[model samples]
Target: MKNTYFFLLVIIVQFTNAQDYYFPERNESWQPISPVEASIDSNKLDAVIAFAKANEYSGSRDLRIAILEGFKSEPFHEIQGPTKKRGGPAGMILKNGKLVTQWGDTKRVDMTFSVTKSFLSTVAGLAVDQGLIANVDDKVQSYVWDDTFAGRHNSQITWSQLLQQNSAWQGTLFGGQDWADRPPREGGIDDWKYAKPATPGTVMEYNDVRVNVLAYSLLQVWRQPLPQVLKEHVMDRIGASTTWRWYGYKDAWVDVDGLQMKSVTGGGHSGAGMFINTEDMARFGMLFLKNGKWNDQQLISSEWIDAAITPSQPNVNYGFMWWLNQKGPRHWNGVGEDVFYAAGFGGNFIVVDRKNDLVVVTRWLEPSKIGVFMKNLIDAF
Candidate 1:
């Protein structure tokens, strides 16, 4: 009976500790604590950093070369937007919302590839939260009222479908064709180009063109550049650094309310997305880790965070642009299934492990080693 009571008290204390998260102020250095203070094994944490540095992503530091060579198989693929030479392996680990440790140049800004999808996902959530979007399930055509969402298949797509990357939205936007983005390596261009698309919500395809469609649609709904909306509502509220910049392909500009607006891409596949530092990525991850709340402010509603993390029907490993660790192809062995993250090309990741009260951001780590790396890091705690 005494042991049971003691266990209950320990659990209560841990819960309280988890709730007392530290949020950093803008332009202030993030408060850091030793691994021992954070209940992490110091030597094991060192090993994790060594492992990450040794297993750097085997891509060109000159990302323009990486992007072009990486997608050489795609038909007519070319760099359409800005690309930056990435820095070495950089990362930050947060325990109970305070920085536990970091390695490499955490301040250097670099392209974060498809992790921008998660930010795009957040922008959609903001729209839903502000009532600009009536419902996630409502067909997108009803909002935009434009030919972009016209046609039988595309008109059937909903905001929810777009968020899930399952909308199977067809056609060309900003010179990018849906089927030409990342077609199967074995097939000829014509085969993929002419293939019938799966119904919206029935298939989750990782196509940048479809992702840009979401960005363009959101642009119409917000009537402003997404970067501005993100800055005003999310980034500024979270106290993120001003150095971060969202970019779109040079050809992705459109007229909105008599003004031209650039529609950002959902990723850096064509070399446009979020160019940000590791610290800002950590801050963004922490926001999601705290269920969209930063200090006293609820920047993004808890309800939207819940919906964002919930797995979509088409992909158990995916949830509204966030990657889930649920039992599926992407599941990391030995890690809690509840863990979710924003994964990008070139091995950038912002992992949110709510169960462990942890947020980890890694850049330029070898992609395949993430599971082992995360498993080891969690074990240290």
Candidate 2:
């Protein structure tokens, strides 16, 4: 949390002082993609920014340049409106131990949903690095308990199955009410019971119950809340001070009785919304680039990262919480091999290009022009 309050100070500080950290010109650094027209196209920029604000997020866009100094640098001096948009998180790049791209509100934090699952995957990677769980194939029931009449499927799903969203236990069988009051496992089929497994790898159904169930069970295995454990093993390693929380949000994802609910104190998926700004995400991405190592410390085993990013089932283009680069379009960054990304519902992304040794993050509108934006943003790199 060091210098975290700096963001609060930025809110009130002299504008000139705050301007220093924003993007500046460098001959060989990254450049931003802005509207190009007469008089700098302020009107078009405003329109684009306005649309982003209305549909995607509440912050601004901060741009930066990544430089290899004399060798190569990204020269994007023309960045505007993306600023302070999307709740204004910071963004930056580091190459060869030098600051390349840097921009707005690095100290600030915001909710970047589904992206939280990617963070969880990173944490699980750490657990794997620690040999806490045997492997991805280990039956999740070995770590979690459903305590329902359909408990037979408890051990049927694997940790990989839950992350891949291939978990077939539908929450609808619980009739949307078990989310509030989970029935006992011994009880006969009730409205609050887990849907019978429809075959683990047969089909894909995005369910939060599987995710929360995985989280609860992992806690039983780790014997600690995930955020606390991650603080020590993951967050602290990347020099992040942002306090990501998860509490009451999981009602959309799990079966929680009063007892289980009380134990969490309501951090849920909102807690899943890791509040760290974009710069921190880049740092975390650096860990992946280094094969989950940083400064001689292998924070997470490369093996785990490999498993986490690799598609578990053949058809699903998802891994853990990371988005598998699905083949579709020739994007702006110019598509190549299938890349993996940590993406939130809106345009929030931490795109990791292992093939290119690059990670491009964007906090765009939730429903905005994310696909095109990603193509353009990466193209600049």
Candidate 3:
């Protein structure tokens, strides 16, 4: 009897999944507000709808909304549900072209992962903007504590190569992630061994190892963690705040041995530029779109903003950590050649369209097949 009941439940889910519709979270009496926007490319939309309808058993959508409840609502959180429970596809639109804002949760903080890379690029730009560093073309060994060469594979690398992510610093003999787990220098943290060399601009391998290298080198030059730099230039300009919240039950995280334990400009470390909410993320997009203008004051220069979006790689459409879609759509040039995005693993995205002034944020479950969920939601926009 129990098996029969479970099969019936599965059949019910399959039945609902066959419908070409999305279910946003609401009370039993809650009703959906239909989307308001121009239709996406018709044929493309139809294809997505067909695919979603056909994949009823693949994944279930977790959609929720509470209009006007403000940022204090519990919705702007890391979804701890199953792999199908979506996070922030949690989107917004601004009259001034701001996006993923207005649903509130603007200042609430959360992990942005590689989206943190975009913030790191912002710091790199500021470093160049100020006289802190000369240019992105300088030698990274010259900036940070180097010594990667005293070994094989890498000996002399340049800052431009690091920014371009061509630093062939073989991370781990096993794999990149294994190498990242244990950095080579000081036995301290993963920012070690950037002192090695690379082919400069000749190769293109997408690397997260380079992201930490930029962080460490910036610390050497900026004389502070990237978080402090971001607090002043990036976060403060957009009115984002920071706090050291309690963990489990003990003392709040503070400096260990008088230096900050570790920091991530874009991944893992919650404090190292991780704890920002969607509204702040939207303002960040706006900052880039308006050429680094927050209201009346000019923060980062327009030239800097333009340079940040311009592609910086021969192999990938990336500029300092920001992804660009220069291939102009309708091509298989890797992940939407027309829709430039800031991608974070575990399904977090900030899709920016400057031509249309649109930014879409989708925080979803990976491991689960929520890609269809994302494509459907994006189709409606």
The candidate that wins on lDDT is 1
Model 3 Cα lDDT, one tens digit per residue, 1-381? 999999999999977643322211211111222233333454554454444334432222322121112112212222221121223333344323422223323334445556777777788889888977776666666665555322444546666666666666554211123133223335433243344334557765555545565665666677755676777776765654343111110111224346753334344322223544565565577667556766556889887777667676564477767777666321223234445667664445566655555555544334133345444545545
Model 1 CA RMSD to the hidden true structure, in angstroms:
3.2
When summed lDDT is taken over every stretch of 10 residues in candidate 2, the lowest stretch is: 65-74
Report every candidate's CA lDDT.
Answer: 0.92, 0.52, 0.50
Candidate 1, clashing residue pairs?
Answer: none
Q: Encode model 1's per-residue lDDT on 319-345: one tens digit a residue.
A: 999999999999999999999999998
For model 3, where is the 10-residue window of minimal lDDT? 244-253
What is the full ranking by TM-score, best candidate first? Answer: 1, 2, 3
Better of 1 and 2 by lDDT: 1
Instruction: After the best TM-score superposition of candidate 1, give how far the Cα of residue 378 lies from its true spot, in angstroms.
Output: 0.8
Ranking by lDDT: 1, 2, 3
All candidates' TM-scores?
Answer: 0.95, 0.64, 0.60
Task: Give a tens-digit lDDT track for model 2, residues 1-381.
Answer: 648788867776756533322222212233333324112244543443444445544323321121012112112212111112235423443333234444455545655646767776766676677788778788766655545214555447777776777766444221222232223345445433444546776655555445555555566566666777777887676665455454423342343342232112111121334555666666667667667766566788777877777765644467777767655332324554466777664456676665545555656455346555445444444
TM-score of 2: 0.64
Count clashing pairs, candidate 1. Answer: 0
